[model samples]
Target chain A: MPKLDFDTINLGHGSGGKLTNQLLDSGVFSVLKNDLLDQRHDGAILELSGKTAFTTDSFVISPVFFPGGDIGELAVNGTVNDLAMCGAIPRYLSLAFILEEGLPMTEFWDILVSIRNACAAAGVSVVTGDTKVVERGKGDKVFVNTTGVGTVHPKAEIDIRRIMPGDKIIVSGQLAAHGMAIMSVREGLEFESQIVSDTQPLNHLVKDLLDEFGNNIKLLRDPTRGGVGTALNEMARDRDLGVHLEQRALPIDPQVAGACELLGLDPLYVANEGLFLAVVSGAAAGAMVGAMQRTDTGRHARIIGEFTDQHPKKVVMTSGIGGQRIVNMLIGEQLPRIC
Target chain B: MPKLDFDTINLGHGSGGKLTNQLLDSGVFSVLKNDLLDQRHDGAILELSGKTAFTTDSFVISPVFFPGGDIGELAVNGTVNDLAMCGAIPRYLSLAFILEEGLPMTEFWDILVSIRNACAAAGVSVVTGDTKVVERGKGDKVFVNTTGVGTVHPKAEIDIRRIMPGDKIIVSGQLAAHGMAIMSVREGLEFESQIVSDTQPLNHLVKDLLDEFGNNIKLLRDPTRGGVGTALNEMARDRDLGVHLEQRALPIDPQVAGACELLGLDPLYVANEGLFLAVVSGAAAGAMVGAMQRTDTGRHARIIGEFTDQHPKKVVMTSGIGGQRIVNMLIGEQLPRIC
Candidate 1:
């Protein structure tokens, strides 16, 4: 990290004056240096063609720093994952920050480094961005917003319309790890082991899947703030189809499950960051799962459910105790700033 | 405007759950209805080709509502202007919001309407976005981030390398109107007439200029946060060139000038919302000024200065009273959250 002369950021750092330039020069620009961003122009110019995917997300994750990742990593991975879910190759990102005055410069530098590292991990560039500061009491520590653009895969045909009743639903990996991690910190709860946020960029794995499956990969979504239950419920409602799940097949870390159980929260309604749900053709399901298991991030991938014509527009889960129940959309916030 | 069931937004609205969907259905989606955003997908897919400009900005302007504009409009126009300055025809925008819990629904709705109106005026679409609500005191009322993408104008060649010593510098309309307007509200000062913010979209006027002047327009920039003084100083430093200005030629609304004088602020150091400084080829400067004067937003446009090699990397202005002084970049916070 570049040594900053100031101990903390003040309103002057956002004044778009001498202080602002100093902040950018020794801080942001020095770390995230690239030809495009280094130009210091109003925006970055890129050569693009074909179908492009555009998306934006603001990260206000509380605690800023969690076990496995910080808000910087989540900000990059979240937007990159969104483009990946659209079957796009994550290319470039625009990162804007809203910093509260009086935030320690050390904390800000750490976040900038994390952003640079995350961008490298995702193989994307921070092309253009803005910085604004509010009075100390007017804002929390910091908030980051990332907007991403990527080109769609040539062979990918990811759409809800492609999902049929016979399509198989697959979970990429363990669930409830991200939400449980934040909850654990917020509630000061502990288990036998530490629960870490599963915040990782899924672009590489998504590209691999799209290259192999092409049109067979019907839809892809990461269970974020609303979790897997909300994602699945929305899919069912939109497609006018039902989803059938086997509780035994839902892969989750034992610690995360325990934490959720202890808190009376269902694992299915808990958020997952690095994980994703893929809807695939029934014939390709088995092969897809096998392929996913060979990848590092998807070692725990499994087929947890299937789309059905029965009980249209609903999600039915068969529990380990042999009882079935309907899974509805989450009505209220389970945890604020869960990311 | 669509009537909402809730009087104020809560954490649930940002939960990505039932309440979140309801908020979107009744608020965002309803006001900014478009086919791309209505898909409710992870991102919007656009068929874009050739050279594109990308930029992002976060607006944390206090007093969400101001004379002649609001934060929403500023959010949209700010990004749109950034793209315009890059010599691109603004195309699509990604809107993201960080709202505080307990914010009145009416305020949020009015902002949404302003955003919609601004988008229409700029001829851009809000394709994808995200909203995250923080705890009541974790954030101020609201913060907005807009990321915009636009196709570069084929005829334009905007670059500092293209600027020469004899290039003419032009200012579009009055200076310090925006900063003074916000200050008037904050200081509770009354002017002979209302000091309204000169906040409006400049993409149309920019398009017209690019279409006509092409490469003759060496560079374009909006004198926003740091005002014209800071922008020119940066330009001079970047190109290792000097800028010579005639104060008699600087345009300013009389009331705005008086307000700045009373506040002990220099008009050159104040912010502007709907003004720009263009560096054009001296041979085409006269024609460009004539053309700009015919446009609605540029009626007061005039040649204010010229690039020179006399004092390299310096900006010197000659006053109407015949005294000369150096103009430097703004050093400290003039007005925080002035947008």
Candidate 2:
């Protein structure tokens, strides 16, 4: 780490003065240095072509540092995944921070390093950013906002309008890990095993899927904030169609399930950071799942449901106990700041 | 008001659940609806070609509302002006919010309307965004992050590398108005006259200047958080050149000057929301200032300083009484949350 006179950030660090410059030069710029960022202009100049995808997300998860990942990693991965769900090649990101005064310099440095590593892992660059500090008690440790821009995959025509009645709904990997991890930490809960947040970048995996499945991939949604159940309900309502699911096919880590059970929470509604829900054509469902299972990001890929004409604007699941039940969208706040 | 049952925003509205959908459907979406936003996809798809400008900023100004403008208006214009400084015609924006729970719904609605009006006024669209609600006391009322994308102007070539020894420094309008406005409200220091923020969009004025001046314009920067002094100091230090300013030429409103005197603050270190500093070729400086003064955004335009060969990498100013003083970048915080 670059040497600094202060151990914690102060209001002057965001004052757009000498202290702000010192903080950026010795801290953020040193960690995430790039040609575009080196320009040091009001904005980054980029070359973008064809259909570009633009998205923004603000992450305010409590406890800046979580079990498996920190807020910095989550900020980068969250925006990257949002772009990936659009069938885009995530390229550039703009990171902005709302830092609370008195935050330790070490913590700030760690977050910057995490951001750098996350960007390198996702194959994207943080081209521009802004930092603002609020007085103590006015903010938490840190709040991050990441906005991503990417070029849409040429072969991909992923859209909700393309969903057919028989399209299969698939889930990539296990669910409820991210939400449970945060809850466990917040509530001081303990279990037989540890629960870690599954916060990882899904851009590369998404690129591979789009390259192979092409137009057969009808839609992709990351089950973040609200989990698989909420995403499926949104699809059903938006398409004015029904989603039929097999409960036995739903994937969940044993630890996450147990924690959910202990907390009286449903895994279906819990958030998933690194997981995604995909809607693909029936003819390619088996082959797609097979391909996805071969990759690290989708080892537990499962064809859990299919769109149907019955029960329009609703999601119905066939349980392992042989009873059918309707899965409505999440009603109230099950968990806050659970991203 | 779209018949919301609640009087204030709660954590559930940001949980990505039923209440979240209700909030979006009745509030944010209804106010900021457009073709791209109406799609309601993970991201907005736009056909952008050639050079693009991307930038992000988080607005955490206290009080939420100020004398001349609110945080919503400032957030939109701030990002737009950043793009303007890059010689880009801002086209699309991604808006994200970190809201504190218990904020009244009426206040939220008013902010939303202000955002809509500002977007319309600036000719930009809010395409994709995310909202997260932090518990009361975890955050202030609201913090907005706006990431903007714009296409670069063809004739514009904005680069500091083109700065010459005789380059003229131009201030688009009066300085310290925005800083004093926020200070007036925050400190509750009453003056005989009101000090209103000069928060306005400078994109059109910049476009016109670029269209006419082309490569003659060397660099452009908005004097936002650090005022004109800090911005000039940054340029001088980066280019390893000297900046000479005439204190008499600096424009400031009478009330603003008096407020700065009372607060023991230097106008040079104050912040400006709707002003910019332009570096132009000495030969075209007079013509450019004349042309700028004809426009609404630059009616108070003045040639305050110029790059000089003396005092390399430092800013020196001449007083009206014929004495020179070294104007340094702000050292520590004078005012926080002025933006």
Candidate 3:
């Protein structure tokens, strides 16, 4: 194949089809050959002598700093939570920043401090980093990408494939707090109560649940950009199973619910930062819920739904008025930069 | 010390001073609690069980695709060269992208194809990756971060710390090609000869040199962001040595030199994507230069300078007119996003 010219980038580059494959073939894969990248999986799977888990996330939030959290905190916790959701003990992280020229150094300092505090609170360490500044106006204020490496217990076998019919789904805390916080701040929405983003790292909370419930936990996910609805839909699709959610059983703060209602948004589609949905065996669901309730971060834990065999690849939500509606994948972009 | 707040960032963060220290202490270091990061050195000192080298780079170049290369190729080659600089055999890479929403899918796909091709040429692999989208206007078209791992031969012990007073500086190929290409396109500078970027992976060239010189190579740097002059200045400062360069000995493509002169830019400060600066003991410099010349990428390699014990942390240049002047560190930001 001919090598890609460096003249310009066309939209076909990102299509995930022939052109995408060509770009990868002509430009990237040609330079750094390796086995793991050849697999082309969603993530890399490694065999390790010691217990370890690795994950990464990138923060491109607009305005750099926003209500509740900024890129710094988001970058840190995002990776930490990815490890936590996997039943891994979060440990260290690699932080890399792409800064735009003319970005105020003071602002970068503020974000760095936030990152330090977040790490301290989460009990993880920042081990490595790379920083680069792009031309002015060519980049946003800053973009943060973080990669985390953690240790997982040897016996843990958590996987989405373990989810079965009748398994109960429990949410860790209030939904839509994060998305509402960002929306309210960005749009200057006035409300009786200010909605703070629930962007806390949940490694400890995850540890607590795993310590009590052991292997009963089938799967875990942090409903972020696409929100809880999208996360559930993905789970259903991945397992070839149906999920039935009860609107009345879902937990939502009044401030977040009111904000979503006012904006004509569904709480189900609003992103959550410090919340997670877990699938546990039917017999262990009650015990898991009880364990979750004992932790402050999981005080709002509730049995929102259950996995089912009917209507695989679909999420059906029983509305407050007793009508069932299919919760399909997100049709379009909703709240932006809620991460 | 007071904790750093996330509400806003300030300029002092990158100053390498009190605020910078606080930012690391309160934000970054607090979250990533690792021994390597705690050291706060120019680069982390990692110990591997086997012969291995690890390096990472983030490409935020504007115009996603530029005159000679794009983010995809740059990410692959940048990391590959970093590992090679450490005398490691280039192998694998992890590619992660932070994409702006509404970026044409076509462009994204093209970049992937470029990545695939670049890896094939470099004999590396894209073992793992992550994809994220931010709201329109929140991010640039795309940002790519690549982390690479390679294995070093057991006998190699390349280190900048080994640089001595009687060391010779050799530059591979022409200087300022990459930077000139970017500037010309960005500024619409018309020239009789259109200068294309010199972006290419150099691990193979590096292999040629290492195979010939063995452990005689003292230091290697790609001369990226701040350019050849900046990279040399950094080495001088880091090694507590003095550098003297002969202007007449430097190899400059006439077109690139003309572009620099026309724009009132210094060719020495312009970035080069496919060139590297190596400092070797005077005794081994001749053999090393011969090895470099054997490779197509290093055909124009030239001996440009030498290191000395006097005038530590200073770089002096013998001008073409026989006048001597100090080459100081870059005082302020030069052309942004030239990478």
Candidate 4:
């Protein structure tokens, strides 16, 4: 095995032969050995019941390794969050890796370990997977796509159709940490304090909300690539409700806010991987925020805004100076590949 | 609409904003206008029952377009075939695209149409999707990852445990056309007759076979990236059964064989898109072959091999010249990125 070991990925590792087996056995399977994936079949078969939630996401962040998380970690958690947003308890995930030739074996191994650890932390299994390698320079170092499958809870009726006016909107935590962290590294900025990506799995937090509220949870959404502003805008447009936010209620870490100000960016439109916005019944808003605050992942939970009948399908924010301003979805990407 | 029109995809198109909506509305949403995808939620909700098969594949095949099909077509059909191989009626797919900055909008639109057409051909809907843009050189023209979800039939009991000695092995069609098609184009070889890829969805053929033989069908698999030889080797290893292939019985197109020889390649190791191998009960083998032959996609189907207890978990090929040789999986990719 030592002599047959590869120092870096080549076309052979993806050939589905001895080399492909070596790579999987030594790197992937060695880290994430589960019954389904270890079956080594083309696909995984499971006995699932009730409604199922399916979601897919491709992670092409510039730096494969980031401040708080790498692309591998983000790939798994992001997909998990998408399923969670639909009130599904994510169970199985299929990972596909596109490895560029010449990517060092150490880096590849590192990402595989990250993926395994993330799946374990999120209480999901890496069930079935594929690996394909391209010629050098034809791709970046590595790109990962994860597709998640989970069973929807019968009591958890979550959708935008139930997003009625007067529903309370809640933000899980501080905003823009994920985006600001990437920007600082890309810009090589020397801030007084370092900003790290807030990349964490939000399924457990969403589970807590669903456990407490059952069908009262109107909707849940994760602000990833396009940030909170875009998410609210989309929810409003789709649900035919207006979102009104109080500037002072939005939670923002002073350091992250300072970094955003330094970079000429608006915090509302910057991505947050660990944070999510939820619309709940007005009667349960107080208890929802209380339950969220009790969780380790949502200590800074705040009622940032609420849905209104006025200005249907639009989002508006009240400024600190008591001025109302329309907050539209960002027409242009302030940051590309922020995911 | 003119001001909001999209000519080419830019950073904004993936920004999840006005431009993203325009691109999705004009291209993705217009073609894949299913209820789940049109819901515009973070994920698609499906009412699935019983055993579910989940599979994922990332298509990074070079030369995005080739003789018979492009990456988009392969993404859909390939996934459909994987799920079908598990005896699952391929139902829904999730498409995620990583587009390089500056990729032409026309090519993007063309690929989307191809994807939609393939989905229609396979009778599966593009339920949910995501699009992301990376800076130029960070990605190839476009890479698509399709994750397919399908439900396993009640009587369709397919598994490796059913594989045993005296079982018959069947091949769906001619081998190596896909690999040779891309190889010819990449090496700039001019052949008297062009070897086009056999890239077609085989869900209907699988359905026909399943209908004919419910639980008698032991196993089904597509011989895609690593060709038939690799696929059989995997099946043998997983099922702990010997696969005895007859060289003279393998259905290889003359042009494809000639091209493989001229290129110093063995057709056994070359990839094929629209082909599969099935192991059925000895009693039902003849009926299975007849059913496959009646289908257009499996018109060239043949009983190329059988299971034997002579050498468990090994694949041996009896050549035309009366010699037995172990047909091991390809140790290295003969044609990388052929998909």
Candidate 5:
């Protein structure tokens, strides 16, 4: 066997192939030496003395910072909501920062403040962090990778596997608000009404759902960069289920709808910051909708869809005029740096 | 009260003045929210249920990476030894990465691998991490900030304040080897002999010391960025004591001396990655020196200096001809990035 070179790394290292694994095994795993890392699973199976939920996310947003949140807060809240979606109480966060030098101290400070504020609002402590600053012109502003650990409630058993064909999908708020907000700022597009980024911390609203529907809440996900449509598509594929969303039933602010139309973007595919998609048993769907509407962040909550075993691994939408279409994962970057 | 501008950070933020305190309270402390951070002390006071040791350091090395270790591994081991200096069993680490993006993944991976390997060699786990990637053209390669935690045996208590005037100061292995290696690589200076980085994990040798002399050891420190001279100065300043070094007693590798002479750099201010200064009580100094010499990493361990109450806060070095001179901290970046 040839001796591995330790001088430089190439793009092939991130290709998830033999070299990637070799890099992880020889370089990363060798140093990280932990049982959890050794598992090499899609997600780590952490054993907790108390009930807990595990969540992981990869952040590759361009331009890192924008009007609302930068990659810092996005990395923090993105995983925080994943745990919250599982009805878990978020408590600890592990942060990883990849930086390119020549970046200004002012911009770094701004992002750091945002991350700190987000953790405080969510009542989670940033127990650990890693920073690596690289040479100039070699990286984008910054890329943050975060993993969250939260304690799950013993009685809360929300799972997508429980969704039946007649299950109802309640969107916690308006569609296209976050996506349009980013587009407006990035493209310098103006509207009759100024659009503000709908970025927010959602742990409080999650607690409300746990208090109301408990286990009947089958699933929850904050529709972010890929939008509500991609989120529904993931849920359908994960459980070998299908989803039918009603376009007319979806609530979209008139301004956001106009902005999407002007930009030739689909409201479903445009990102949302403060919105969550909830799948509930048909019996508890109405009560869940009622509970969500009571919160200020969820006043626009609506029953936008239903699950079906008929069209497996698909998300079909019933248009306002009765037309039908399939919703899929984003092919490339859309409205880059909306986070 | 005036509304603060959110544009850029000024030097005052790091000055440890009013602005620095405000930045800490409003930005950093607000996000961290921990008791240890709230104490507002030069060093955090951690209450150990069992036995433990405390260590603190401020890292501001330029270029961050050179021939030997980068800021990442340097940050890890620097504090790791601070604990080892106290006979503490290092077990956990907390890392903070301040990044300026546009940094190549290649450099990031190299440093990351170094950090991973260093932690493994030290028998420590990085339990928590924080990362912030700044904008392009704003930061140098990268700067890593690290804090470490370790456990000590119940019977161990190594105190620098207990050092008597006649105590022996031992230099572990060769002086200025790491610094010279960095300069050779950075300046592209080649010699008949290759000057390999003297960066080696020293926890194992520390273990040997504990096994041999235990609490009789007064203090230990890896002469890193500022070399042995600055480390001794800091000890003198902190303990309000004088340190006297005999020129003939100091150990310097022939190659290191040649490299320093070629580069016009002082060996006293040059960095040492694998060397440490140990202040020991007279009774056990001989046994400790014997134990250090027996180890592979410390074969050249020799008595270099003594402590005294005279000439307070001064580091006096006696010349080979019996003359003396003062050694002080390097005023600015020397052999930049020679970590």
Candidate 6:
């Protein structure tokens, strides 16, 4: 790192001048150094073959720093997971930051470190990036937009359209941790246990599951902004299929459930950063669960439900008491700017 | 398009609820509709081969709508130019939007229309996108981040490192139009002719120069945020070479020059959305200029400078008065949030 310090970012840092270079060199480039970025060109040039997955997401998560992770790691892992959801072996990412003036340099530096570590954890490189500054109050502290590109592994043929009736729907680990975690901090609720954001890089866990299941894994989606219910509901309507979810089998962290109850929110509608739902063939569902359970991030993997032909284009939830009800996707945002 | 209508975007539009689907299905989904995005999946899947270019840029240009263009086209073209600078045949783009809760639906629709036309004009597909909403005052109307991927042509060997002594520097057209245009609107200053933004897509113009010159074309850059001077200064420093620019040879529209004179700004340092610089071998300088001049976006193209070994990594300007001076990269923003 260069031996220059500014308490916070000034307009000059985004001026594309000496200060911009100074800031990038000292804070970002020093930590995320790589060959493609070192080229310092407008874009990164790479060699590739076969199918590629492309995705983009901007993290404007309020309270830039949250329990278990900050916006930095979330930005990196979010895009990486989007690509991974498509069975793409996450390889490269492009980061863009729109920072508010007067943001503490120390805060920015911490984010840079998180991004660097997250990229390493995800086995990807941030090959290109851009930064812009907005006047104070016009922007949140820092909003990150990350676009990722990755090559799809040949053995993986994942697609929602490929999902058929009788396919088992398995959710990786617990649900609602990420959303409830944000709610906890935002509402200043002190529980026996602080709810931690489930923000993590899921590429390794995905790789392991894909390796064992191969083409048997029909679909994968990280239940993020709209949570598992919203993601599954959309899939149901998009593919014109019925999904039957069992409440007893659904894995939820007791702490997250308690927090949601206090907030009068449904855990099914809360978001998750590290967890994903997988639709696997019945023949391979047991093996898929086993593979996920072997990984640290997925040790709580369970078969939550399956696709059914009874109610086409709808999702039905079975209660523990044998009662049934329609599980509606969220109608409006219960929590705004929650990532 | 769906028949539902609303005057402005409400929190529901971003709620991932019925409103979110309605807005997307009617407005965005109707205009930039394509297969990869229509899949309703988390990410787009594409097939690729050979060398590819990956780049990203976030547009926070204030006064979303301006003289020559709006933030919509700028978002598309800015990304397209980044890829074009890499000697890549621009193909696909992913657009992400962060809209404020109270933005007018009509205004958003107009920008959506502009984005569609720019994409068609540039011959690139909008394959995937994401939308998020912040509270009314938390965001400035809308901020867009576009990430693009393209296939590199076989013959082009564009690189700043390829630049060497005796190379000729050619600019695509008149400078300072973009920055000046933004300043005029923001400061509420009006010129006799109303200096419009030179915000056109330059992919075809770049392709023409590359097709004719091939590897003879050593380097390419778009003078967007920091203008021609900053772009050249960066190239000079990056390659450790001297760039000698001719003041009289520089192309500046009469109206743009007049506006600059009134504002006490140097045309050299103002931004240009549609302009680019080409460093070609001395032997092919004339041919390259001639090629650029014949194109619509490059009709005013001219030779602005040349590289020399005398002062490595410095840019010197030779005025018509036969005086010499250093042209520095902008130290601070001349105009902020001007794209």
Question: Per model, how much of the real contact set is kept?
Answer: 0.89, 0.90, 0.12, 0.85, 0.00, 0.74
Model 1 lDDT, full chain set: 0.92
Cα lDDT of model 4 by residue, B1-339, tens digit: 223355667888777766777676664456667777853678998988888989999998889999999999999999999999889999999999999888888788779889989999999999888898878887889999999999886668888888879999999999999999999999999988787999999888888788879988988988887789888888888778798999999999999999888989889888999999999899999888888888788889999999998898899999999999999988877878887
Q: How accurate is candidate 4 locally (lDDT)?
A: 0.87
Error of 2 at B269 (Å): 0.9
Residue-level error in angstroms, candidate 1, position B181: 0.5
Report residue A20 deviation for candidate 1 (angstroms). Answer: 0.5
On lDDT, who's better, 2 or 6?
Answer: 2
Considering only chain B, what TM-score does candidate 5 achieve? 0.77
Q: Which digits, one per residue and each the tens of the lDDT, describe model 3 over residues A246-329?
A: 999999988788889999988887777788988999999998888889889999999999999999989999999999999975
Q: For candidate 2, what is the TM-score?
A: 0.99
Looking at model 5, residue B197 earns an lDDT score of: 65
Q: What overall lDDT, based on C-alpha atoms, would model 3 receive against the true structure?
A: 0.72
- CAPRI grade of model 4: medium
Q: What share of the true interface contacts does candidate 1 keep?
A: 0.89
Tens digit of per-residue lDDT, candidate 5, span B1-339: 123333334333322223333433444223323333421211222222344343333243554676666766777777677667656777555554544544554565566667777877787755444443444554455656555555664445565577778888999988887767666766789988877667777877887777767777777777766578877877887678899999988888787788888888888887777778888887888888888888798899998988988898898999999999997755444654353
DockQ of 1: 0.91
User: Given candidate 6, what's the lDDT at residue B268?
Assistant: 83
Residue A143 alpha-carbon offset, candidate 2, angstroms: 0.2
Per-residue lDDT over B266-309 for candidate 2, one digit per residue giving the tens place of the 0 to 100 score: 99999999999999999999999999999989999999999989
RMSD of 6: 1.4
Model 1 reaches what TM-score against the true structure?
Answer: 0.99
lDDT of 3 by residue, B210-241 (tens): 77787788777887766788778778877899
Q: What local lDDT score does residue A284 receive in model 5, on the 0 to 100 scale?
A: 92
